[model samples]
Target: MSTPVLVINSGSSSLKYQVVDADDGGALAVGLVERIGGSGHGRLTHTVDGEKHRSDVAVPDHAAAMAAMADAFEQHGPDLAAAGLVAVGHRVVQGGARFGHSVRVDEAALEIIEELSALAPLHNPANAAGIRVAMDTFPDLPHVAVFDTAFHLTMPEVAHTYAIDRQVAADHRIRRYGFHGTSHAYVSRQAAELLGKPLEETNVIVLHLGNGASACAVRAGVSVDTSMGLTPLEGLVMGTRSGDIDPAVVFHLARTAGMDIDAIDDLLNKRSGVLGLSGSQDMRDLVDAVEAGDADAQLALEVYCYRVRKYVGSYLAVLGRVDAIVFTAGIGENADEVRELSLRGLESLGIEVDGEANRARSKEPRDIATAASRVRVLVIPTNEELEIARDAVRVTGS
Candidate 1:
C-alpha cells in the first residue's frame, strides 16, 4: 500500500478533507465536516472504498471536527496507521507574499500564517485552527501548508501592484494577493495536457466560477495576472460579493448615507453580487427563473456572464497569444447557459463555441470550441486536493 497524504481545506465554519495517494492522485477516502460552531446540528460524513458513513453530532469547534474525522477513519476502514500516512497538507487560503511555496509546518511557519489572518479574515483563522488540530492529532507525521496564493507568487510585480501610494501600500501590505491559485494551477496544467501542448509553452485563461469566483491569466505555466485583489472579494461577481466596484462607493455610503465602514463592508461582501441583483445566488435557480421570464434573474445572469466575458477579453490582451480559455468550478463547468452567454461575442477574438459541445454535459475535460476557432475553449474540472497532496509529497520528500 502506498502512503497517502491527507489534504484538509478548512473554512470558517466547515472542513473538507481527502486522503489521496500521492503516487497516482487517487483518493483513498474523502469527507467533509460542516457547521462547526454554527447555529444548527453539525455533521461529519466520510466515504471510503465506495462506502459512505455519516454522523450528525455537535461539533463545537475545529478540534472536535478533527477528532470526528480521525474517528471516522478508525471506524470506517484504512486506518491511518495502516495507510502509511506520510504527511498532512493544509490549504491555507492567504499566504500573502511571505510564503511563495508550500513549506513544512513549524512554529515560525504557523506564526506567519496567523499573521496573514488579517488578509483573509474569514479563512486564515479557520485554516490555522485546522493546522493546529491536525498537528496535535498527528504530532509525529509531517504537516505541510499548501497555500492557495503560492501558485500566483510567480505573478509579475507590475500585475500585482495596485495603483496607490507606495509607502502606505507597503506599510499595510495592501496589494493584489489573488486567491484560487491552486485551482487555477491545476486546471491550467490539465488544459495544456488536453491540448497536447507542453505546459511551459501554453498560455491559458482560467475562470473558476463557483460561489466565489476568480479569473487567472497563466502564460507559459506562470501566473501573469489574476482577478482577486488584496482579498477574495475583488474578483468576479460572486454569490454575495460585489466584485470590481468603485472605491468611492465606500466613502459615499459612509458620508452621504450615514453608513459606517463595517456596514458598507457587510453590504458589499454579504449583501451584493448576484444575490443582490436577483435575490438568489445559485445559478441553477437563476436559470430556472430566467426561463420563467423573471426579469431580475434575467438581468443578473446577463451581468454575471458579461463580467466574465470582460475578464476573458482583458486576459486575452494580457496573454497576447492564448492557446485556450478554460473554465472550472461549479458555474463554469456546469452552467451551459452561463458559458454560452459569456462567450457569445468573442468570435472576433478567434474564440467560437460549438453550441452542441457547450451544451453537452460531462465531468471530464473536453473542448467546447469549434474546430475552426483559433483558440480552444475547454471545461476542466479542478482537483485542488490532488494538487495539495502532490505539493505535500514534494515538500515532505516522502
Candidate 2:
C-alpha cells in the first residue's frame, strides 16, 4: 500500500514542496516556488523522476504560489488529483509551547499558529498564510502541521529552562525551543536502525550541520537535550549565525559601537558565523581556502569544529551512555574534513572516526566509527519531508 502526502515548507517568500510516500519515505515528486509577491515574476521548478520542468510566472501571494504549484502538477507528471495523496503536511518552524506534536489544521489551530507569529516573526505568518491558501486549494484533503520544535518538546524542564527572571520569562514565553526537530528525529531513528538496535534502547547524539546547525541528544527515542534555544540563533556556529555569544556583547556593541538592537540582531544572524569569520559561507569554498593556507578560513573551521566538539561532549554527559553519534544535513554528511576536525581529540570519549570510512563518500546511511570505538559514529542523510509525511498520516489517519 502506498501513502502519498504532500509536504509543504513555506518561507516568507518561497514555498518548497514534495509528494512523499509515508510507507517507504521516498519522494514521488518535488517542486519549489520562489520570489512570491516580489517585483519580478516568480519561478517554479518541478521535478518528476529526474525530469525537471521550470516556469517563470507571476505569483503575487501564497494563493498565487499555490495556484502555480497546481499548474505545474497539472502540466508535469503525477497529477495531484490522481496521485492518491492522503493528506497535506506543513512544516512549521516554531510551534511554541502549544503544539507539542503534529495537529490537524483547523480554525483554532490556525489562529494559534498566527498568534505565535510574534515569537517567529519571519516564519509563522508565512506558514499560516500557506496553510490558508493550501486549505482552499485542497479542500478535500486533511492538512497537518508538523512543527520543527515538536520533537524537542520532550526535553525536561532542567534541559529547556533558562536562568532568567521567572515573571518575565513566564510573561514572555521565553525558554529553549529547539529547531531542526524533524532532522534530529529522522536521523536518530535512522541511526538506531543502522546500528541494528531498537530505537527505545538506543542513545544517540545527532549533529545536523548545515547552514543552520544544531546538536540533539536523543535518549531512548526521546529528545533529552538540544543545542538550539528560543530561536535558531542560539546553537552551534553556522554559515551565517553567530552561535553561543555572550548576551552582554549586545550591550557592549550598543554602548561602544553605537549599534541598535536590530543592527546587532542582523549582525549575529546574517553577517556572522563562518561567513563573518572567513569572508565566505560555503563550506566547500572555505575548506579549499583552508587548504590554500588562508588564516581566516582556518580560524573559521577551528571555531566551527570547536563548537561542535563542545556540544558533543556535553550531550555525552547528558545521555550518560551513547550508542551512536550520528551526523546528518549537508555539511555533516558530505564534509569529511569537518567530521574529522570536529571529533579530532574525542578518542578518549569512545567517539573515534575511522579515517578511511570517514573519507569514503556515499548517499546511503553509513557508520564511520572504528571497530574499537565504544560509540558508533554514523552519517545519515536527513529526510524531513518523509518524517513530516509520516506524522501527517498518523495525525490525520489518512
Among these predicted structures, which one has the highest TM-score?
A: 2
Per-residue lDDT of model 2, residues 1-398, tens digit only = 99999999988999999999999988899999999889999999999999999989799899999999999888887888898999999999999999999999999999999999988999999999999999999999999999999999999999999999989999999999999999999889889899999999999999999999999999999999999999999989999999999999999999999999999999999999999999999999999999999999999999999999999999999999999889899999999999999999999888889999999999999999999999999999999999999999999887
Instruction: Name every residue pair that clashes in candidate 1.
Output: none
- Residue 177's lDDT in candidate 1: 84
Q: What overall lDDT, based on C-alpha atoms, would model 1 receive against the true structure?
A: 0.93
Q: Please give the CA lDDT of all the candidate structures.
A: 0.93, 0.95
Candidate 1 lowest-lDDT run of ten: 1-10
- What TM-score does candidate 2 get on C-alpha atoms? 0.99
Which candidate leads in lDDT? 2
Off by over 4 Å in 1: none
